[model samples]
Target: MRVLGVDPGLTRCGVGVVEGVAGRPLTMIGVGVVRTPADAELGHRLVAIERGIEEWLDEHRPEYVAVERVFSQHNVRTVMGTAQASAVAMLCAARRGIPVALHTPSEVKAAVTGSGRADKAQVGAMVTRLLRLAEPPRPADAADALALAICHIWRAPAQNRLQQAVAQHASALKGRTR
Candidate 1:
């Protein structure tokens, strides 16, 4: 599966594409940060992010988009911006009918590094190793985005099985009732 992972931020939204299935090495199709002027108006920043995400969608055409779920932070303003940027990413994927998955930072960290509390450097080092890159992607955000993609690629199979089992159970219940 091809996944586009988004690490949303007003100043620097990270985007990356990874393609492969579980138990196999994945390939990085692209990785970069979408920068919007920190001093720009909120609306303009969001628009810029929209355009950048749209471009990624057009180019990579991922089957799924894995975005970091916004969590509460000490700074309300920072959290608000992150939530806004995250919403933009979900909107972009939904508009294209591509499924969007929201993964918490801890969940992604654990999937990639086997530790939920792994630091940025640890996560970066793992991403570099997983992708077999000579070095970690620049700007911690970029590596984080790639890590998100790798996490999704590895986790999706089990998630799909769980979802199917739930659906089958519901269908069996409906048949019994009818």
Candidate 2:
């Protein structure tokens, strides 16, 4: 499956496209950051992000979008910006009828590094190694976006099976009720 992973931020929103399935090496199709001037008005920044994300969606046409979930931080303002940027990513994917998956920072780290407490450097290093890249993606955020995509690709199979089991159980229960 091909997935577009988004690491949302006000100034630098990281975006990457990865393709492959579980138990196989993944391929990095594209990786980049969308920059919006900090001085730009809030609305303008969001617009810039929207345009950037839309262009990504158009180019890659991913089957799923994996976005980093906005988690609480000490700075309310920082968190607010992140939350907004995240919403923009989700909106763009939903508009295209693409399925969206939200992964927490810890979850992503754990999936990539075998430790939820892994630091950025550790996560970056693992991402580099997993993708078999000669170098890690720059600016940390870019590496993070790729990590999110990798995490989703690795976990999707289990998630799908759980959903299928739940659905089948529900259907069986309904038939019994009748």
Candidate 3:
């Protein structure tokens, strides 16, 4: 499967594409960061992000997009920006009819480094080793984006099955009620 991972931020949103499946070697198709000036108006920043994500969608044509789920932080301003950026990513994928998945930072960390509390360096090292890259992607955010893709590539199958089971159980329950 080809997966695009997005690490959304106001100043620098990381985007990465990886192709692989569970229990198989993954290939890094692309990786980069989109930068928007902090001084730019809110609307302008969002526009920039939208354009960047659209370009990526058109260029790589990922089957799925894994975005970092926004989490509460003491800095409400920062969180708001991140949430906005994440929305743009989801919208871009939705417009293209591609599936989107949101994974928490801790979930991503655990998937890549075996520990939810793993440090940035550890995650980077693991990402490098997993992708067999010569070096870890820079600016932490880039590596994070790649990690999100890798996590989804490894986890999505079981997650899909669980969702299917839940839906089937719900359907059976509804039929019995009827």
Candidate 4:
């Protein structure tokens, strides 16, 4: 499966694309940041974000988009921007009919580093090691995006198994009724 993970920010949104299946290593298809001027108006920043994400979707055509869920924290301004960026990401995926999954930062950190409260450096280090890269993913956002993809890969099996069980049960019930 090809998954695009997004770490949304008004000024600098980070995106990473990885292709892999459960229990296997992931291949990095692409990784980059979408930058908008910090002084830009909120509407303008959002428009830029939408356009950037659309272009990325057109280019990569990922099967799924994984985004970080917004958490209410002390910084109201940061939270607002994060929420808006996430909205743009979801809208972009919805427009293209691509499925989206939202994961919490803690969930991503835990998946990558075995601890929900793992620090940014720890997560970055793990991302570097997992991808077998020489350097850590820069600027934190990119690292977070990679971590989000990892979280999805880890979580996907449980969901797929549940779906398969449901289908099997339905098939058995139909056979008995028929």
Candidate 5:
């Protein structure tokens, strides 16, 4: 499966694409940041992010999108902007009929670093090691995005299996009722 992971921000949104089979290592297909001028209006920044994400979807045609969920404190403005950016990403993916999974920052950190509270540098280091890259992914945002993708890929199978088991149990229950 190919997954696009997004770390949303008003000024610079980070994106990464990774491909992997169910039981194989993930391969990095691409990674980059979408930059909007710091001085640009919030509306413009959002538009830029939307357009950039659309372009990415068009180019990569990823099967799924994984975005970092917003969790902020004492900064309503920042939280709102992050939420808006994440919405744009979800919208873009939905437009293409691609399923989107939202992962918390803590989840991504834990997946990559084995610690929910791991620092950025530690996450970056682990991301590099996981991907077997000679160097860390550039721009902290990009690394975060990649981590989000990794987390989703690692978690998806378990989620799918659980859902399947639930469905099977429901079907058996219905049969007995009949």
Candidate 6:
């Protein structure tokens, strides 16, 4: 599967494309960051992000989009910006009719580094090793975006199965009620 992972931030939104299936070698199709000036007006900043995401969606045409789920932070301003950026990513994918998945930071960290508490350096190192790249992707956010894609590629199979089972159970329950 081809996935575009988005690490959303107002200052630097990371974008990466990864292609692979579970239990197979993964390939990094592309990786980069979308930057918007902090001094820009809020509307302008959001528009920049929207354009950046749209360009990625068009260029990569990914089957799925994995976005980092926004989490609460002590810095309310930072969290708000991240959540806004994340919403733009989801909106872009939705407009293209591509499926979107939200992965938490800890979930991505554990998937790539075998520890939820893994540091950014550890995650970057793992991403380099996993993709067989000569060096880690720069700016940290880019690596994080790739990690989100890798986590989804590796975990989606099991997650799908579980969803299917739950749906079947619900169907059976509805039949009994009828």
How many backbone clashes does every candidate have?
Answer: 0, 0, 0, 0, 0, 0
Give the alpha-carbon lDDT of every model.
Answer: 0.95, 0.95, 0.95, 0.90, 0.90, 0.95
- Which regions of candidate 6 are displaced past 4 Å? none
Candidate 1 local lDDT, residue 134: 92
Question: What TM-score should be assigned to candidate 5?
Answer: 0.93
Model 5 misplaced regions, further than 4 Å: 72-75
Q: Worst 10-residue stretch by lDDT in candidate 2?
A: 68-77
The residue-by-residue lDDT of candidate 2 on 77-134, one tens digit each, is 6999999999999999999999999999989999999999999999989989988899
Per-residue lDDT over 121-171 for candidate 6, one digit per residue giving the tens place of the 0 to 100 score: 999999999999999998899999999999999999999999999999999
**How would you encode candidate 1's per-residue C-alpha lDDT over 13-127 as one tens digit per residue?**
9999999999998899999999999889999999999999999999999999999999886467799999999999999999999999999999999999999999999999999
Q: What digit string (tens of lDDT, one per residue) describes model 5 on residues 66-105?
A: 9998877736778888888999999989988899999988
Instruction: Give candidate 6's error at residue 2 in angstroms.
Output: 0.3
Cα-based TM-score, every candidate:
0.96, 0.97, 0.95, 0.90, 0.93, 0.96
Candidate 4 vs candidate 6, TM-score winner: 6
| Sequence-dependent TM-score of model 3 | 0.95
Which has the better lDDT: candidate 3, or candidate 5? 3
Question: Can you give the lDDT of residue 160 in candidate 3?
Answer: 88
Winner on lDDT between 1 and 4 is 1
Model 1 shows how many backbone clashes?
A: 0
Tens-digit per-residue lDDT, 1-178, candidate 4: 8889999999889998878887887777888899999988989999999999998899999999999999877468699899999999999998889999999888999888999999999999998888777899888898888888878888888878999999999999999999
Listing every candidate in turn, what is its Cα RMSD in Å to the true structure after a full C-alpha superposition? 1.1, 1.0, 1.3, 2.4, 1.6, 1.1
lDDT for model 1, please: 0.95
